[model samples]
Target: MRSNHSASRVVWTLTLCTSLALLGDSTLYAVLPSYHPAVGIGVVQVGWLLSMNRLVRPPLNMLSGWLSQRLGPRTPYIVGLSIGALSTIGYSLCRGFWPLLAMRALWGVAWALLAVSAYGLMLDVTVESTRGRLAGIYTSISYFGGALGAMGGGFLVDALGFSPAMFILGALSIGASLLALTLPRTQHLPARHVAPGVSLAWRPRLQAWAHALRRLDARLWLVLALSFAHRFLFAGVFYSTFGLYLQQTLGESLHVGAAVIGVASFTGTVLFLRNVVSVLVGPGLGYLSDVLGERSRVLLLGEVLGVAALACLALADSLWISAAGVLLAAMAYGIVPPMLVSWMGDLTRTGARGTIVGGYQTMGDLGSGVGPLVAYALAAAWGLSAVYGLGAALCALTVPLILLVRSRAAGRAPLAVADHGAHGA
Candidate 1:
């Protein structure tokens, strides 16, 4: 599969974009939790700020997906990369309460635009035979990028200054944008390309939305449900709670928190891996997913290990314990996402590729936004410990849901139309 030249080009370019974008994006989480107190805000406000960045994604994803085939992956890919570069620069230059919040809100849109386009493009290059390995490779690249960004962002702030670090990262992102232009011009063709008379008026967009909604099947809903739960626990409750645990409970400083957060938090590649097992073992694990031919089983095995690891992380009072937990969890966490993406690719049609990925991401984003708020609420009511405990439960809950999901059904031949009159499928 690595011998496939076109797929190789896709991976490297996509990997470069993921690395550079994450390098810039990682700067925010590097400082945000500890910086919150410096700015005279509290836990709840911090969660709100974090959630604000995720809140706008669902609708934007839908719109981006709807428009993807029309504009082609190339256009959005360029636009998204540009926005990512600018937004990191925005984080560096902005301050004050409302201004900062507004900036975060805007970054949310930039993130969705960039991510949906990347996912759409990744899928564009391969069919089902290559899907599992490609998905694994793509995710592996993202994880590796995230680790570099997390470590680099912290080291940069320490070596130079916040603004300087951001500027460097933003410039890298811009370079990746340029690299995107070099992607092979001949690739996946749109099932329906944009015509001259195409219009994005509200009526048509709304109709498309309604038509798409009616097309949703039991399998997609199950995947979305699994996606939602995965993010809600991992992204929301676990993230907000863990930062408080490290800072207040462990009495660590910002730098310590940044290093450890990536290890403990389930959310983004914001995780900086001191856990060497994941890095060393990543390719093998990815290969296992491809070889097994049963993604849900591999996914479930990882989830089980991840949930157990999260519990250990919650109670870890020493660095070694924390490292151990992170190592175990990383092994599992690394497997699940790529498997899920592969599964979705197996489920989707050529025409609805972007829309399906968009919906998948949209649900994940919703969980990301709502998860933190829910964690905050749980923390407020039960205590910070409860958030991790409940989050573990949520992770466990998804395994059953994964089992409930029927194996991926591909092509239009097997799919029954939900509303033939509306979509004319």
Candidate 2:
């Protein structure tokens, strides 16, 4: 019963952290585009501003992980949440794009600190067998918060105006900050150092990070590549431009676009229920991978299915059709987190998990940052449909790369496979 209660608390803590992390992203989407048009920025330029938020994540993530290792995860987590809460309120005071962009960059730093610390904590508390499922739950809570923030922000913006909406988001973030304070304090192990009295230079950390990256098996790199492409396409087109697309292509109002996206996010959160299924099935899948020796094939198959879903979005003509496509994409999207993170855990030593995962997330942030610019350029040249088509194609390409990795790892023992299968994988 004690153990069960502890598990429950961990789950709640992770959920709350994820929700807080997502709030800024959700509210930014809600407030930015409408404000942009009101202030005379064109549709394309707005995409750039959205991309700016993601741009700050990679570097900050690298720093946050090191800081967490030194300071303990909870401090940075609390500080990040506080910053996010304050920044959300700051958005309302901004008069133009530059100020808003600056605020978003700062928000990205907060997101990185909180997200890296939260994930590190999640990993610390969870066992290997259950990792996949917990990742699903974490992501689900994130999307759910996104859905609520988007929906609530939209309604609030329509009813109360942008300033009030920002204030409300700020208040919610502060609430999350309060909740963050209750998280169990993590005990840090003694640091493993390379040399005594190495000054506070990032060079050693950067080199260590590079070595970790190099240590990633070719198959893992492929998975990372696929993840990169997936993020690039999604961030660039769907996330960055979807609102503008609805406005220009569908003749929808800003409120309507936010509603559609919010509803889509809610739909995506619903799909995360499958993570509960993933928790049940994830171990089975890991066991099956151990049994059949075809983990890569399973991953490839999932990626292929995701590609098809992206293609469906590309072909979608109506809003309903596009939404259906999103649902399909969500299904595929939901499957990857558990399997991929678990696989990474399988590959790395216990000591390096935080650093390695932080690096992977940094790469993800890099992909996310690049995605928007790429999509914006593509959209400027071709069309929105073309962007979707490219995303679909990229998803398809990842399958073969995943296959290559699977084939390579097939002969190796599953060293990292957990005994009881903790939920952090």
Best by lDDT: 1
Single out the weakest 10-residue window by summed lDDT for candidate 2.
416-425
Candidate 2 per-residue C-alpha lDDT over 9-35 given as tens digits, one digit per residue, 9 for 90 to 100: 775676776675566568666566666
Instruction: Provide backbone clash counts, one per model.
Output: 3, 12
- In candidate 1 the C-alpha lDDT for residue 115 amounts to 80
Q: What is the C-alpha local distance difference test score of each model? A: 0.66, 0.65
Which residues of candidate 1, in runs, are more than 4 Å off? 1-3, 32-51, 91-103, 185-215, 246-271, 274-283, 310-324, 407-425
Q: How many pairs of residues in model 1 come into backbone collision?
A: 3
Angstrom error of the Cα, residue 304, model 2: value is: 1.6
Q: Estimate the overall C-alpha local distance difference test score of candidate 2.
A: 0.65
For all predicted structures, in order, the TM-scores are 0.78, 0.76
